[model samples]
Target: MALKQYMKTLSCPPGCNLLLDTSRFDNANSKLVDVLVNLKRIGQVSVPNTDENYAKIRQIIGNTINDPSVNKDLIIAAIMKTDAIRKRRGNSARNRSGLGDVFGGMDTGMDYGMDYEQYSKEKVTNKDFQANFTVDIEKEEKIFGDKSFGETLKDAEKLGAANNDITSIFPTAKTEEKSFEESCPKTDIHCAYVAYMENYANSLLNFKDFTQFDGKWMIARDKIAAALLHLKSSYKGKEVMQPNLDNFKNVCRKFVFLCGTKANRERSELVKSAIFIASEARADKDDLEIHLTDLFGEVKASPTISKDAAVQNRMLGADYADSVRITGSWRSLGIPSRVNGAESAIDYIREDNDVHSMHAAWHQINNQREPRDRKRERFFYFHNHMLLRIATERASNGLPAVQPMSNDVLHMEFSTEYNIRPENDPEGILDDYNSPPKTCRLTRNTQETLRNELRDLVRYKGLGMERFGHHCEQNYHADLHNLLMKDCDVGMLGYFAVSARPPIFYRIHSEINRVWHDFYSNQRYRRQDIYPPYGLTIRGITLHSRCGRVNQAETFWEKLGTHYKLNHQNFIFRIRLYNWRRLREKVIVRIFMGPQNARLENYFEMDRFVHQLDGNRLSEIRRYDKDSSFVFVKDQNDCGWPYHLMLPKGGDKRPIKYRLLVFVNDVHDQRVNVGTHPSLNNPMCGSNRQNMQNAGLELVDDRRDYGFPTNRRWTFNPVPIVNNRDRYFGYMSSIVNIVHTGEETDFCNQAYFR
Candidate 1:
């Protein structure tokens, strides 16, 4: 019956405008072959005249169409039977090189010489057939004009059938392979450097010869200079390297001493050579130099660690040292960061290294200034939030909560004069020996500089409230945090993995948050402007779990490691928006969450983005927790905040009370395109970077800052403003509570939340 349904969908041929009648063809094996011949006559299928191809086709039909266990095989045979009628009519010169030639002379190892009787009698497993037919179905469908045929052939080949000759019946276009040099853009020094390092790291000469140099820094330096000179001469006129050129050079200088005693130094030199060549060839020297200074000046000032154990103990836990070493080596290849066809710029940022040298290198190389900076700030906030939440959960679990390292402990008083303050100094001794040298004891001049930046960030009112001044203030605070910590070592509060695991990172971010609150506290918003435009009203917001509506949810830790898990129940927010204007309109929906009865400034942004409403009607919007804009759905090795950590870990003794706020505002400029990737259209992970870069060609996903209402402080009480005034914002006060479930509970199945 499934085969019949599949056959019914097959078109007769181009211009025929008719689907095949499955009723006309019987289910008999010979009848199926007759159908294939008829299909070939009508130009649908393309079966090679070779005996081996015919035998494989007959075996596939005999094995699948008659067997109940192999429905997929039947579909394949049915598609091929119908496809031959359409494909054979147009091309008389179909390639007849058999299956070997179709698979680019690769041996399929199928016994095409087997007789039909023996082949039919022997049971062909799907796994065995798939192993032999390894052609990509999508690629095959483009060539054969039948997706089912491609799928079936792939399946049949996997089954223990002599189906290797199937491809010879329908030839596919060959895709051109791109070389590393050709693939890397001339102006992207980062791309070239990564590519060069990948090659150097994997090469035999680098491991055998370069490792022999050991502590011979002088000999290695000369060899590095020679390599750089060669690289410069080779691509002198066509390449431009910037951003991470200094990092590349620094890695070279540190070499076997800092990075490793093996070939890592040589590898670094090779990468530097590529970047230098690219920069000298086409880059503006002055601009490149300026960017290097602005971005990587800290890398130069920070001293390299002589011991891997020290780095592991200081930045990450000593237990993670092995994992870090393994992961770092894997990350250094930069294979994960390489852009694929469907990946946008934001996608690259999400997948870039979270730890190791590559983390900083990734940002420098993929130089999309606005998106990079915006993502950087968002990442900082999100990461810190994760740390704080996890710490809360740990404290609930009877584990000690991570404490924030204070700046005062380091004698970093803003009024102090520049002086050398050592760790063991009696007057100003520092306790955290693990902190980066610069951060442990700041000179008086450095203290003054940091103080000035913080003061400016706190006092600044921004351009104006009318033009996203709140966002400007928020970004300014984040940027100041980066500026303050620029001189810190790369692994210590500079990169994600290391920073997230440290107490000092929280201290720095807490300071930024303090400034952000100060900036927003001084700003005023007109009640009229805060109100939703175009007569749109958010009717109400409700929370629901898998079982039913719920007022509370539970969170627990997964069985292993620091990973926490939300109760299995999938939580969703159902929002109803009424459009009183009586015309279709776009509106932005901003969601914020905070501790119940807490000050408005304590709220944390949950999700914010533009959503459209039906004209003259109420539109119902359902948002799932997994689809939060701040998290990424699991995709390969992509580095994102885990989805399970979306909710805060509740208290063990009592449930943690929280408020859910939803705000709706009318979109004035419809012309501003906020689009997402065609493949991954979810607004959950934020905007697509490529779309933002090519606004003319593709639409951006979202234009709002990472945090909306929560990005700024509120002078007036929002609950009253939303509820009492009948404004566009819908306030669900004290709607949700998070309880800490000490045991491993699968909430999705057990209905514990309900």
Candidate 2:
């Protein structure tokens, strides 16, 4: 329930018993309250007694965030319920007044009353009041060097500096095998900025230019509300709840514009001449040029329509006035891009404007670029490959830019990584992630060894040999000979130098803290090395592995049938495992495909081995999961799941206490990459706190059913990329009960998705 307990619920490394004890309470409800407290602490929760219902609410929320598409009402309802609880709790809730005295008595319209001038004064002085403004070029250059932060940040791969490829280690077949594999960083985080902006704009827009706060806050309030509502609504209904900060910003940006109120009749009449002055008679010969000075900047009205007028308005005839006013200023304020929390607001400009022409002009010609921003404007933004590169470079080099612990996330190459660590076992010179595998001699000797590893995995693990046997010749390893000898596209990692990755699958649990989730249908990428092992999955995480090029609407199950000879029995095991994961938290189940109850005692020692690794040297260095799964995660602080490369066979303890950190020759300056906030000149640097903790706390209920975890609780570890699709179970009744507010989709479109 609490942010700390979130990982615990999932059976992740709760890390640091001391921190766990400090955060966890002994009572059942106390753990539930933990999550809410964390959301509130991070400024996401907005309920009365947030501290009380935190964990329970999060348990509900965690489910919804896991698959937001079908759970829209769940989160909103929880918010309302939390509010109700606050009302019931009276004094206890008041102490946690996140809404503050300023939002006093929001139930009735009377709450609208506020001193706009006074509020503005307050905003100016508030410690959190950082203006969304930019500085002169000289200052910007000094801080980020000559490279404009905007330019450098346009590409996601460049933003993270990931290795170009080589990371297809985890399994998720359906996601890989896509044609378009551009690694674009999510722009949805703009929702936070949108929230901030709407608050700022509301403080200004709703102003009656008077001391009375009553009427003015309505406009500001509505705009912000509309944006928030628009953004929240989408994620609430997703099958796989995704939280993209970029999309959040874009949506909010558009919604804010759309939320703008139209010009009153009085203003329209006054500016009648710039538009068509049709009282009873005709349409104008000239283009209907309405003055638009109010929206852009402060200016004096002129008696005539000066051709070169810097300040302008929408062109309108009488009938056109309403459309122009609504579609231009009012509608522009809430452009879809803005509403969806995206950058490049121009992308969502209304279709009413000749969209093609405007886009062509905006992108192709310098003339159409914003008049004032010509000196520093660019047309394009980051793509996926670039994002992958940046992220890989950062991850391999142990840089803060990209996180690697999340499953199947490192599936592709986005950049030409210039410098970084290799991902190999540190023990041997010939480790999987480091020291390139000896060039596979095309000689008969090399081919035999290659065939052997494939044979081993397939014969013992029931993978590769059978699957690829049909696709190739007797010496299947020969394929690599060509890939390695000619293309140079693939690289060596050890016994198997796989160059592809499954499509990127961000750990769903990783997004537990945020209020919104984003879901998409067509997120696929190239092959990764981990595709082979994911077949042996059951439960918590979604498993994604490679599939050949697919068509639209092709489900994972359909692809699985075509790729393998699996039947209902095997499928049942996979499905049951997935369900178990969603319901139970922090559980990692391995469905051994080979003989069940077979003697695997040698391999079975990992449970105790991991316990021995409790005080690991790597753990001592203080790194947690790299990509804080959700809610302003400070990577490696809470969600890291680092494992040793290549398990030791016939194991007792290892030959040595080896701890390896690989640096890729390709990755660029890996340590300092992070996303840039384009809206603000001075972006936030580093993170607030990682809260690195490993509570190792477990919930107690029926003992036999839980495999005797005892002190070590049975937490669920999501098998990412395993579940074919979200299917019918994503939004179970229990999840709905906690998260849904009973509000229909859009609180209006009950007829549809809700």
Query: Which one is best on TM-score?
Result: 1
Clashes of 1: 33
lDDT of 1 by residue, 683-743 (tens): 3222334333333333343454444555555555666753435444444333676665554
lDDT of model number 2: 0.21
Worst 10 residues of 1 by lDDT: 13-22
lDDT of each: 0.39, 0.21
Q: Write the per-residue lDDT of candidate 2 for residues 295-319, one digit (tens) a residue.
A: 1111111011112221222333322
Model 2 TM: 0.15
Q: What lDDT score is found at residue 311 in candidate 2?
A: 22
* Model 2 residue 353 distance off true place after TM-score fit, in angstroms: 32
